[model samples]
Target: MNWLNKLERKFGRFAIHNLTMYLIGGYVIGYGIYYLMPNLLNWLTLEPGMILHGQVWRIVSWVLIPPSGNILTIIIMMMLYYSLGNALERTWGAFRYNVYIFSGILFTVIGAFILYFITGGFIGLGIFFSTYYINMSIFLAFAASYPDMELLLYFILPIKIKWMALVYAVMILYTMVRGNIAVRVAIVASLLNFVIFFFSSRNMKPYSPKERARKTKFKQQSRPHMTYPGGARHRCAVCGRTELDDPTLEFRFCSKCNGNYEYCQDHLFTHQHVK
Candidate 1:
């Protein structure tokens, strides 16, 4: 994590902002190619055999492979992934988000080559590696960050993010269990980023309804108990404002102060510490 922090500090400025838009655009272009020149897709696929035979472009071109054949499915998939991807960018900043996505792609590429070497050129029947699971990694990060967030499943039934994540986890588990060696390798390779980031990053801690309630209770209990002469709950030492002034105003006691001195939200960080 310290290394990641240092890397972020060093290269954060170069991080591409709004990277999800470009990814969706790539999908659109890929769909266009799929429709117009369907035969070209063969050359663009991530085939290690093809690459070994002098087709170097497959390394990058394979990223543009459309995840689905149906137009509606592609549209919905793009929208869903865009939403999750942008949210992750906002939460982690552009650099970390880019690292996560690119790491998945890198791992998938490595997995493809490894498969090629293992199987002696017959990697799989179809495009072995794709961005499908890279997009899935975005959802995993979203669920980890906002486990309590809910969505209307199919625009009717309400479901929490964590529940949906659980469903995806089960599906992946089933695929790994029943799938062939190629399929299993592909799934694990694509999801390696999520596995690495989730384990390495402390922010990906598991959250549940019980954990949420416990955190809320602890926060409420941890608040300082101070009483003014007029039965007032909180009074800012600087501006002398009380709960009677504005019911919504937050007050926090300054730790640096010699005695009990509180400040409202506006001055909590800006106010000088009492010596």
Candidate 2:
């Protein structure tokens, strides 16, 4: 997680904002390609065996494979994934969201190659390694972040996200049991990011904006007031402003400073530390 933070600080600007649009667009283009030239998908799928035989483009082109052939199914899939992806982006920021998605893709690619090697390059896992599980990962993350959020199941019964996630979990387990080696690999690889993120962030709580604001307000109110020589309390050491001067100014003690020095939010990260 520290490494992720470092990477975000260095490459956050390069993250694609609103990445869900591109994913949906890819599916649209894939569907068009599927309808026009169905055989072309054979060359575009993730076939490591074929890649060794001079079709290297298959590595990236595999993403062009539509998850389903049914029009209605694809439409619903796109809409559901788009909403989940957008919500995750807003919750985790663009960089982390990019990492989650890109990592899933990377893992899927790795799994394909591993399967190819294990099976002696005889098996082609293109069909198994679709964006279906990647999209499922997004839903799992959204459910974890907003467990209490409800949605209409088939536009009739209201259900919580946690319940949906649980159902998906059972489905994945069923697939792993009944599916072939390639199918199991695909499912695990695509959802690996979700597993990694859930464990890595076990200590951290995902809070909604309102809940975050409430927590901040509570902390501010409960902070012990520091008394100064002139009977001043809640003062910023750098700005030399007390709560009496500006009642709205929040103060926090700097852990890096040698002594007990407080700073306002504006100067908390920018002010020089005491020796």
Give me the candidate number with maximum lDDT: 2
Tens-digit lDDT track of model 1 for 1-275 = 66778999999999999999988898888889988999988888888887887989988888888888577767777888888888878777789889999989999989999888888778443466888888888898889778888988877999999999999999999999998888988999999998888786665332333455677776777454566767788888778888888899999888888777789988888888888
**Can you tell me which runs of candidate 1 are displaced by over 4 Å?**
123-126, 203-275
1-275, model 2: which lDDT tens digit per residue? Answer: 77888999999999999999998888788888988999888889898888888999988888878886577867877898899899888777899899999999999999999999888877556778888889899999899888999999988999998999999999999999999998998998999999999876644354353565677777787555456656677778888888778778888989999877889888999998899
Q: Residue 162 deviation, candidate 1, in Å?
A: 0.8
User: Where does the lowest 10-residue lDDT sum fall in candidate 2?
Assistant: 202-211
lDDT of 1: 0.83
Q: What are the Cα lDDT values of the candidates? A: 0.83, 0.85
Count of clashes in candidate 1: 0
TM-score to true structure, per model:
0.75, 0.78
Query: Each candidate: how many clashes?
Result: 0, 0
Clashes (candidate 2) = 0
